[model samples]
Target chain A: MSEGTVSGAALRILAAGPGVTIQDAGRHGLLRFGVTGAGPMDPLAFALANKVAQVPDGSAALEISMGGVELEAVDAAITLAIAGGNFRVTLDGQAMPSAARLTLEPGSKLSIKAGEEGAWCYLAPCGRIDIPAQLGSLSTHTRSGIGGLQGRALAAGDVLPLAEPKVLPGGAMEIEAPVLKRPGDVIRVLLGPQDDYFNDAEIAAFLNGPWTVSVRSDRMAYFLDGTPLTHAGGFNIVSDGIAHGGIQVPGEGFPVVLMGDRQPTGGYPKIATIIGVDLGRMAQLRPGSVFRFASVSLEEAVAARRAEAAEVVSGWALAPLVRTSLSSEFLLGCRLVDGWVDALAED
Target chain B: MSKPLIEGAIYDAPRFLNSGETALVVEFGRSVEPEISDRVLSLDAAMTALKLPGVRETVPTYRSLMIHYDPLVIDRATLIAQVEEIASRPGTAGGPASRWVLPCCYDPEYGEDVGEIARMTGLSEEKVVSLHSGATFRVYMYGFAPGFCYLGGLPPELAVSRRTRPRPPHPPNMTLIGGGLAIVTTFSMPTGWWLMGRTPERMFSPQREKAFLVAVGDELKFEPVDRDTFLSLDARAAAGEVVARREALS
Candidate 1:
């Protein structure tokens, strides 16, 4: 944060396609009350978005899923960072690079369109966004409507007020965007809590088959379209608490892989769990996307997520990059109204 | 999961199944029972008392307790070992932590299923409400939705299997008695259960300091209320007025 407090225009959504949400780290320690810990679906990307913009890790960032958003800064100068998916970003008609930081003057128009390769993208600014916290987090559990911008998906006409930008007289910054592996046919999982329900042959079938992500998918769970994972006997277990990524095989024979917005407990037998590191990848793939599940050891799963945190200290960088002004005719529209930053700075 | 010998009904040890790299589900048995719930609660209480690092949170259900932790701080092996050590000791049977008496209005306007239950049992609607409100039921566990409780202790006369066709968009704060089971839904989620009455008390509110009104080990008994009373209390609840009637468990 600089010594100068630049109070300016908040963000207004001229249009929001679908599944746009505000997410941060997460809301933890509330599972006993049946509240699922709502957080960013792509946690690694969420963290990097904060880092790229030089904001706190838990700062609120937009989680836009397979959608487009038209936004404009109401007033003030704010720096921005965008990441995740191979999303197409344009500022007032000029293309913007992914994971690059730049300043947005008042009325600066920014647009994000979902790319073919990914389903979700993140838009982060250098300063923290001001939003009411629910259950200790700003992340929205869309199903439960539990937090973030009134606990619902962002639609047209929603205005988001942000705190002042903390740019240190910087030019431009670039963050190392981890190469998101969108293997059309390979997702690693750790077999689990009810894996005993499946026999050797069933386990083999699960490992061998490629399941297509069904249209019936959301933050709660993903219904995969493939040969159902076999349950040797009754698929019922004594009702128990379920975890994120729990692959529960119900009577229907298909596996319902639970995610961030899942209920606290379930009764179906869970044969496996998708490793945490792979969840971001899983979240980015759209329905009809085919994928295969490969079994990983728990040691392998834990090590992969831990490896990311280990990188946070030195693994991330703030490289020097040049930021360019977009093709902005709106600047003149506002400048004619005598709302230029230069005039304000002189005052 | 292994079954215990009939002669030795008590659990000697819990089978701690790995939910994922970061969680473990400690299963006591294969069925729902008060004692199974007791063991689950006791294990949760004990493990939480230990305050092991990286222990994120827990969700206790009918027969198991799921422990969510940070694998970076505490590996799965060490966490399993810690829980295994705790489970080997004599289990503490936790009693009801608190008691609440909720007012339920079974009038037709509120009791969508009361007539159905009365007709099915050859009893009056009055009898259905009395049977529901007469006995004290313990909260076995909390799940399905935030503050949606799975309660036990419905008498046989009131027993009815859950509806084969689930009703979509069921109202929240409704008291539902089904197949000798009961629950007060906190969210307007779909349910196949038989709804017998409505409660004015909002058990789940996001803005409250403690969002959940009851816990897994709490006990609640329903008292029948007239429609006028129901409306009054409901209005107060809607206005963010204090509603749940609570007392310390003896």
Candidate 2:
């Protein structure tokens, strides 16, 4: 109810994947109440999809994963972009590129298939998806059912209106995908407050093991099957607040990588924390993928994050620009502070 | 209603845990003690007052406090140093907290596990209700679920172990007891804890300007009410009216 934008034309979601939810940045500063910060699994992908759509900063979008989504634009035309996970999209019997910004004419049927690579993809409209904000965000924490289109996943016949619709002069313009890769299955981590809980041998086992992402994975945490980390001391520390990406090793010994919708606090011993820079890279890794961990210092983590932030803003991984049958140019000759098409705008 | 008294400090220096590049945990001790909880709140108060750069938010628990921050704005060393300095300050003591009186209906229809709780505690049903409601509880932490506070201060005589089997899906606002602890859940959750009574009050609602009904360091004393009164209060609560009564603990 405290959302900023007013709704316009509606987007009818005809079908969706398992992990699909509406997400913005996150619901922050509420972890004290045990509310996890639920946002896009891949913040870079979320940001890129918004950039491709050329929507206002912090616009809410639908995140699809595992499977895909089928939707139709009802009553009006709007700009749309599909980014992350390299999903296969088909627009009304015609195969279309997934990451390109395109306009959806009224009654357009768009079907999506899961990406061959990553786990989550973003469906960002040039207009914000109209959903009531819960705790100052549209992001859905599906486990707790706190946010998104009525605090759950979108199914068939969910009519989602645009917060601010851009009239039909929509077109396709693609940006080079930012370099989000970390080369292979290695996940970078910072040694923890509870690293001392485990002896040197346990730490070595953690760094030198081939971990597999379990099927039990969700936005909350990824339960990994790897070398069990034996606690030198008690596995149960006094319960404490969890940082994003904190890894908890319970008495069972297996590590659970806490994700976006993780519990705010826990009693398990955390041996390490994954750096925020590679969280998306880690999230994109599919179940059964060989997961590995590498230790890094706090200074290294911060430096890597700074580099990633620069790539998000300055990287020219944009695909070539084009106008589809229903396309309009939102980036060209507009009041955007930049007011110019990002580099490599063509065709 | 009475509050949990704060005992003297037990630990000399707090233990620090690096939660991540963005967070740090200051732990006073492992066991649950009144003084440890007090120190957690006091350090939380002190840290918030410092307004340390890059410090985003702090979560206070019974034995520790987790500080979430933005590393881009502040370095880890600077944040840790600032927290240590602020924590060691003489004025880092917390102020008194409020006392909240919650209503509980111990009728069998609402409290499906009331008989089970009584059997587990080896007490008669009437005696169980009186003993459970009569005791004053301390708000230790809010976690596992939103607005779900860890209520301590259960008397040893009425203490019992958690159920070997948990309920499939437990409803919210039920006064649950297990492992010598009591909780009035804010939302429906599957729990190993036993449901002794139900209340109509909403401990947390997203619509409210302030979401939490009771914070950590507060006291929650349950007042037994009839099913009719519970129904009326539930209706009033649904209409966005305040039902959980609070008073100064002076």
DockQ category of candidate 1: medium
lDDT of model 2, residue B141: 86
Label model 2 with its docking quality class: acceptable
Q: For candidate 2, write residues A1-347 as lDDT tens digits.
A: 11123345888988876767889888887888878788888887888777767776567888887778889888777767777777787766556666766666666688778766778888888786766788878888877788887788888888897767664232444546546444448999988867878888889899878899998998889999976778886676657788878999988899999998888888788889998887888888888989688998888988988887777677645443443243235434332211122322332
What residue pairs are clashing in model 1?
A9-A74, A9-A75, B160-B179
Output DockQ, candidate 1: 0.58
Give the per-residue lDDT digits (tens) of candidate 1, residues B5-121.
342254556777878788888877766578878888988999778989999898888778999988999988898888887777877875887888998888888798899989889
In the range A142-220, model 1's lDDT, one tens digit per residue, is 7677888878999999988888754444434456544443454687888888887888899989877788888999888
For residues B133-249, what per-residue lDDT tens digits would candidate 2 score against the true structure? 888888888887787888888877667877777777777778888777777887888888888888888888777777788878888888889999999999998787778889888
